[model samples]
Target: MTNHTPPIIGLAGGIGSGKSTITKCFNNLGVQSVDADDVARLVVQPNSDCLNKIYQRYGEDILMNDGSLDRRSLRTIIFNRPEERTWLEALTHPAIKEEITSQLSKLTSKYALLVHPLLFETHQNAICQLVVAIDVPKEIQIQRVISRDNTDQESVEKIISTQLSNSERIHRANLILENTGNIDEMNAKVFKLHQNILELISC
Candidate 1:
């Protein structure tokens, strides 16, 4: 039988909540970290099997002039039509999950951290013993998205609507990492939490 020692920590949050930064702190401490967003970006690169399948399903209009996946076009299609979104997820999510699971299994660290935006929403709790949700205020998330992505308030609301609410995620997680502070504060909180996670994982 295959050994089933799983990841020790799962870091989750909605977009613009500094989940990447939190994962980086763990990286500095020599923890193995895998980010789903980064994986998603890689999985959708030009000429990738996922991108080719999407092109076949959705047509060439979804490609930019440079022949890369036109994320805006795909996003518009997915957001405007839930059916389309489900189709894309059906095609891609399994591949993402399988790749992540494989990478996690290959890690040599004493513990691993899965940094996922939708850990709770996708019910990936099986991978990690301690699920830490980064708690950022809804308004802050909206403002960050608006400023960082140059998107409008309506789009921000729509993206937020797609995610599980902060309270719901908090209730689902084993721990919560509040992240509505400056970089120094964020680093401190992450460091403290990493220690706690190490202790917990050692149990």
Candidate 2:
């Protein structure tokens, strides 16, 4: 758990709180990032063992004609049913964790960013040396999600309901980055945070 080993920085934020923006900013500063969403998708690709487990649990209907897991269909199922979501998480989380750990082990940067929307829910924050939550109002989250995802307000709210609230994340995180301001303000916060993180790791 020494900082000399390239600390894992968990970027935890709500559905539309701009975690991706922070991740991109870190990337611009030459920091390595591993996104849990990307790892989740990768583990379920056409021929993966995780996909086999999913098919075994949900049956052939969850698969496409091309033998790939129909992610949209599965997402609909799990999000609507807590039992199903739990079952799916149990099957996939372990694999995702393994892959993320492996990827982090290979990072050469001063720190590696683990971008996860469900960082706290999945308990992925346990692996991070520091956790930073991006903050925004619930209204802003809903509006931004609707605009960015082309989804309805109700749908965005439903997704938000499933995640830990902004306040909870802010309380739990080591630092908080408020995103209510403009992009320039957000960039400044990211830059300052980057310097602060570098100093922390160096110490």
Candidate number achieving the greatest lDDT relative to the actual structure = 2
Which stretch of 10 consecutive residues in model 1 shows the poorest summed lDDT? 1-10
Listed in order, each prediction's TM-score against the native is 0.93, 0.91
* Count of clashes in candidate 2: 0
Native-to-model Cα distance after best TM-score fit, residue 110 in candidate 1, in Å: 2.7
lDDT string for model 1 (96-140, tens) is 887778777777676888889888777777767889988989999
Query: Model 2 residue 140 lDDT?
Result: 91
Least lDDT summed over 10 consecutive residues: which range in candidate 2? Answer: 1-10
User: What are the lDDT scores of the predictions, listed in order?
Assistant: 0.83, 0.88
Q: Please identify model 1 stretches exceeding 4 Å from their true place.
A: 1-6
Clashing pairs in 2: none
Q: What TM value does model 1 have?
A: 0.93
Over the stretch 97-145, how does candidate 2's per-residue lDDT look in tens digits? 8898888888888889999999999898988889989889999999988
Model 2 misplaced regions, further than 4 Å: 1-4
